[model samples]
Target: MEKIAAIIGGGVIGGGWAARFALMGWQVRVFDPDPEAERKIGEVMANAERALPMLYESPMPKRGEITFHDTIAEAVVGATYVQESVPERLEIKQKVYAELQKHVAENAVLASSTSGFKPSELQEGAARPQQILVAHPFNPVYLLPLAEVVPGQASLEVIEKASETLRDIGMYPLHIKAEIDAHVADRLLEAVWREALWLIKDGICTTEELDDAIRYGFGLRWAQMGLFETYRIAGGEAGMKHFMAQFGPALKWPWTKLMDVPEFNNDLVDLIAGQSDDQSGHMSIRELERLRDNNLVAMMRALKGQEAAAGKLIRDHDARLRGPLADEVPLVTVRRTVPVDWVDVNGHMNEGRYGQVFSDASEELMAHVGADRAYIDAGNSYFTAETNIKYLDETLVGEEFFVETRVALGEGKKLRLLHEMKRASDGAVLSSCDQFLLHVSLETRKSCPPLPDVLAAVEALADKHAG
Candidate 1:
């Protein structure tokens, strides 16, 4: 049975939720009175379709259907999950919940995307308060992973299920034990916002300068290590405790006016808006979104190499999505879309990426022949001795491609293989590689013979491919 997710609002956040669910192979039902909801959601989906799949080495699941409904009942009828992304008004949300509770499944996770309201506040006057929880996510919800899940009185089973569902769609569901107004991230953001406003109003820095301070410096660090971890590195040999002790005195300094509220006057708005316009107002919102998405994809892909933070989540999800190697003579391996990061200034895949793809193909071949991770961990593994690659044609970003590997020779410590990469759409040969590898003992770091079982499996594969 196909999984179904109902989105109660089709604004930016709701459309993002729809895109994420649909892209992850969940049929989406959206309820929104806005006549432009379909067009808005369609734009979000287009951006999602281009960006999300580039984060993985494997193809994403076939996109599920997205249907817009006029009534809440129609949207939530068979949905196992319902995400509420309506207006922030408490009365409006409560009214929607009342109508939703009447039609949605008893077990459906009715989650709100409210950044300010606590789950307890959202649950007020609901027929089933236990069914509602706070699952607040960041902007560009399809790309970013964090989802703050605050369960006020929701059932434990419901929370677990919601977390699992979020994980399935590549989101990190941060469980907040105590329901607070504006859980975790937003609170930290509010502090920064307050300080930034003060800085702008006091004529210290323009909006562009404040943004530059973040993007050019600490923002990069925060992307991977986050606040405490990044600060711990500043402690030198002593770590977080020492760092905290050293900087703890600075907390009393009047450097920041976080407690002060800026007057919500038009002048302040004009100041910020005018400066922001001067900064990056030349590009359309869609253009800026695409630019942001591309930058995020590049950064995340770099992090994936180190298997750190959001990159680790992506790596784990990719492992789950990866299928077993197909049983064929020339083994099917390295099937993936050419990611945006793979393309160089020439507007084609960089030459180095070809080596990585062929290397992946060889790794798949290694795993297929019994010399898997376990075998490698047992002080034995293959090391590339030689490679000869012939670039036949240029491959562009977002082009789907696959490689076929054939074991030319597999005897004792020697393994020779051939790889051909072809575009999936037309089956045009893009590149070919001839590779030679040798089994090595990890302890000695020297060439050695493989284990009997591994040697036997490799020999069999080599023979099969020889024909």
Candidate 2:
């Protein structure tokens, strides 16, 4: 059966949710009363298509169907998942859910994108209330991994099913144990907002300055270690408990005005917006979002290399994405869309990045030859002794590309590989890399003969890929 998702209200969150599922090969139907619904969703999907694939190292599945519908009933008729991103008002959501409950299939998991309203609040006065849960996702949901799975008086089965569905589409479903007004993430966000508002209202910092403090400092640490872990690292030799002991006394200090909220007056809003524009007035909002996405993709991928935080999630998902390659043609070692972050000031992929790209491709070939992570863990693996690269053409961001690789030689302890990087659009050879490698035993840190099984697999591949 084809996996289908029905999205209620084609707003930013709804459109993003649709993009996430649709990009993962799920047929998505969206319903909204607005005439501009399709256009809005198309815009969101365009942004999603450009950025989401860049986050993955493996070839993505084919993009799926995205159809806009006129009515909720029509949209939900056969959908396996129904996500409601209606306006934040409880009455509006309740009215929509009442109608939604009437049409959605019994097996479909019903979800809400409400950030403030608890699942219990949304569950009241609704038919099959147990089916509805607060499935809140952050803005730009296509890139971010978190999807807060807030359960109400719902069955554990539905929540578990929802969790599976979210993970299938590359989202981290954080199950909130006890439901409250805003749930976990937003409450933390609210605390930060209060402090930021105070800073702005007191003229202590401009909006740009406030943002700079985050992006340049704690944000980097928070991206990987988070608050607790970052604090734990700060403890030096003693660790988290010692750090808490040293910092606990400061908790009583009046360091922040968390209890107070500044009025979101028009002047304050204007002041903040004016400062923001002055800071990044050179780029359009779309251009800014692209920049932001590129930075995030780069940061996340860097973390992935270290197997930390959100990077680990991407790695885990990428591992599941791996499958056996076709037995025809050159082995497709690296197939991916060029991420925006790879582009340098010259408007092409950086020279250093090309090396990383080829290395990744070579790693894929190694894994295919039975010299994968396990082989490395077992203290034996291939190490590139030398690489000769020729860049035939410049590659830009979001360009589809693949590497054709073949084993040129596989002897007792020596291996040689050939790689050709081609642009998908024109089949142009953008680059080529010829790598010389040696199997090494990690325990002794010395050249060693390859394992018998790995050598056999390598020789088989070499024969098949022979000229």
Candidate 3:
């Protein structure tokens, strides 16, 4: 059965939701009164189609269909999930909900993208209020995993179902127990935003300078370890308590005008807007978004190597996406899309990435023959002795490719693999790798015969591929 998702507004956030759900194999129905809604959402989808798959080594689910409808009722007809991204005004949201309830299924999970409004506030004077909840997501929803889920009046079943749906589409749902204005992340952001405004107003720092201070400093730390963990590290050998004792008193110092409000006058707006324009006015919004996406992909991919933070989420999702290898003559060892970050200045997949693909294919083959992670951990494993790679064709970013491997030799203490990488769409051979490896005993760090089971499995594969 195909999952269906209804998006009530086709703005940036809504379009992102649509793209994410669709990319995750959910049929998306969209309704927005804007005449250019389709074009806007189309542009968002274009960016998403290119960027989202880069975060994973496995190929993404086949993209589901996206359709625009004239009315909310049409959009929600068969939807199991409805995401409302209309304007922030409470009255407007209430009206949309009222109309949506008329057509939406009783069991459907209705979520709002409002940043400030509590689920309790949105549920007032609504039909089946228990079905509604706040599922606030960050911008570029296709990439970011965080979705602050505020259950409010919603039932436990509904909340569970909503969380399951979010995780199914690769989102991390942080359940907020109590309904509060602006939720958790934004509340913290508000403090920083308030201080930033004051800084600009008081001539302490220009917008660019303030941004530079963050991007070149704490922003990098925050991306991985976040606030308290980073601060704990700052404490040195004593840990968090020592750091808190030293810096806690500074909170009382009049270093920030956080409680003070910068007047929302035209002069203030001009001052901030002029500085921002001077900083990044040269590039169009789409260009900026692409640049941001590229940077995020690079950073997150780095995190993936470390298996921390967002990278862990990505790795887990990749594991879920990966299926068992099928029984074939030349075992299909690797099937994945070339990520954006894999491409170098040459505008094609880098030579280094080809090495990675072959190495991964080799790992897959090793796993198949019972010499997997556990086998390696047990002090018995195959170590690559030598490899020769021939790059026969150009491979570009977003290209779907698979590697077929054959066991050229599998005997006492020696294993050789012949791998051919081919483009999925055309079956064109992109590259080939001939790898020679030796079974080694980790304790002695010398070539050794594999354990009985592993040796038998490898020999069997070699015999099968011998034809």
lDDT of 3: 0.93
Alpha-carbon TM-score of each model against the true structure = 0.96, 0.93, 0.95
Query: Per-residue alpha-carbon lDDT of model 1 for 349-384, expressed as tens digits?
Result: 999999999999999888887888998888889999
Whole-model Cα lDDT of every candidate shown, in order: 0.94, 0.89, 0.93
Model 3 residue 87 lDDT?
96
What is the lDDT, from 0 to 100, of the residue 286 in candidate 2? 86
Itemize residue pairs with steric clashes in candidate 2: none
Where does candidate 2 stray beyond 4 Å? 440-449
**What would the TM-score be for candidate 3 when compared with the true structure?**
0.95
Ranking by lDDT: 1, 3, 2
Candidate 3 lDDT tens digits, 1-467:
87999999999999999999999999999999999999999999999988898888876888999999999988997899999999999999999998988889999999999999999889999989999999999989999999999999999988999999999999989999998999999999999999999999999999999999999999999999999999999999999999999999999999988788899899999999999999999999999999998888889889988999989998898889877778798999998878888899999999998999999999988888888889889898888999999999999987889999999999999999999999999999999999999999999999999999989988999999995
